[model samples]
Target: LFICIDHVGLAVPDLDEAVKFHTEVLGWRELHREVNEEQGVAEAMMGTGDQLAENARIQLIAPLNEDSTIAKFLAKNGQGIQQMAYRVADLDHVSAVLRERGMRLLYPEARRGTSGSRINFVHPKDARGVLLELVELPKEAEEH
Candidate 1:
């Protein structure tokens, strides 16, 4: 079952600039940052509230390579919101449900995401033109 809106993924042309904008201008805290070579993107998580709290946050993602999905997104649509992520209690069950409902999953299986969460995306066409993500966070990361 779905827990909550985990984070909003934003595609940006420049990762460093986006991080600087959020941290320096908006005064949001940079919770974490990392480069996911497998995904070919560099990402940083920024939030306004408590770091340990389960709150909606922004995930700034930029292309790490020309062939990355972020690069293609920037090329086709410029920089903007890319995906809305929902945290799930059981990713496998959720995936099965989606498949049973005939929804198209972008990935055949869950893949490693930021902060070591298992993540998968639903095809945008099946989600009313907006890409949707399902994330299963590590046990230790869950709120009490």
Candidate 2:
């Protein structure tokens, strides 16, 4: 049901500031930037621009509204590890298993996520106080 670690989500107060810091200090290149309106947040993926894909991903996220969860987290805890997303082969199977085990889900159903993959987030309570995001890509979506 689960594949591998997709990416680590880091909440940031300001996306541009974080982006500039990472680009200038760490020398990472910006791979993509996107605003997930449904999720009420914006994000940027930074990487080394080399052959290694997984080694250089740093996702910076900022909230779109003051009332948003990200905004609340930033206000209370400051910018830090927001969640960890894992790539999965079968979202339904994973969700069903998690439900059977009494795990709480942040999203009742899978929704659109970055890179065109379907995603669902598990509650922090069930994920050892860390939000867990599960991502699954359709076969057709993976081909391209």
Candidate 3:
């Protein structure tokens, strides 16, 4: 159903501070940064070293406004790990199989994700309280 852990999402109150800490203290390098208006988030994708293609990354997400889910999460639980993403070769097929197994997906259709990957989420309740995201990297983005 999945290839590997794509990236772990962290909800932060401040994106710059988190990125700074991750880069300076934790030694993670910032690979990408963007504001997803549709999702009401400003995120930074951090990688460990040279292998950006295969390495597991950490996504630091901060709320763009109070209406953002990240803001709500922070208000309720403070800053921390928010979601776990699993990489898939075929998101549509995997989503279908998961649905057949009685998993409740959060979206009816896949949405755009970091680096133009297709993504969808499994309901937190269905995944035992951890928000599970499934990501299918674009074909040309895959490491050969």
Best TM-score among the predictions, by candidate number: 3
Ranking by TM-score: 3, 1, 2
Q: Report the Cα lDDT for candidate 3.
A: 0.92
Off by over 4 Å in 2: 50-55, 138-141
Q: What's the lDDT for residue 71 in model 3?
A: 98
TM-score of each: 0.94, 0.88, 0.96
Which should have the higher lDDT, number 1 or number 3?
A: 3
The deviation in Å at residue 49 for candidate 3 is: 1.8
lDDT of each: 0.90, 0.84, 0.92
Tens digits of per-residue lDDT for model 3, 1-144 = 888899999999999999999999999999899998878999999987657565669999999999999999999999999999999999999999999999999889999888888999999999999999999988877764
The predicted structure with the larger TM-score, 1 or 3, is: 3
Query: What lDDT score goes with residue 107 in model 3?
Result: 88
What CA RMSD would you report for each candidate? 1.3, 2.1, 1.1
What lDDT tens digits, residue by residue, belong to model 2 across residues 1-144?
577787789999999999999899989888889999888889997877643234547688999998778899999899999998888888978998998899988778889887677889899987889899998865674544
By TM-score, how accurate is candidate 3? 0.96
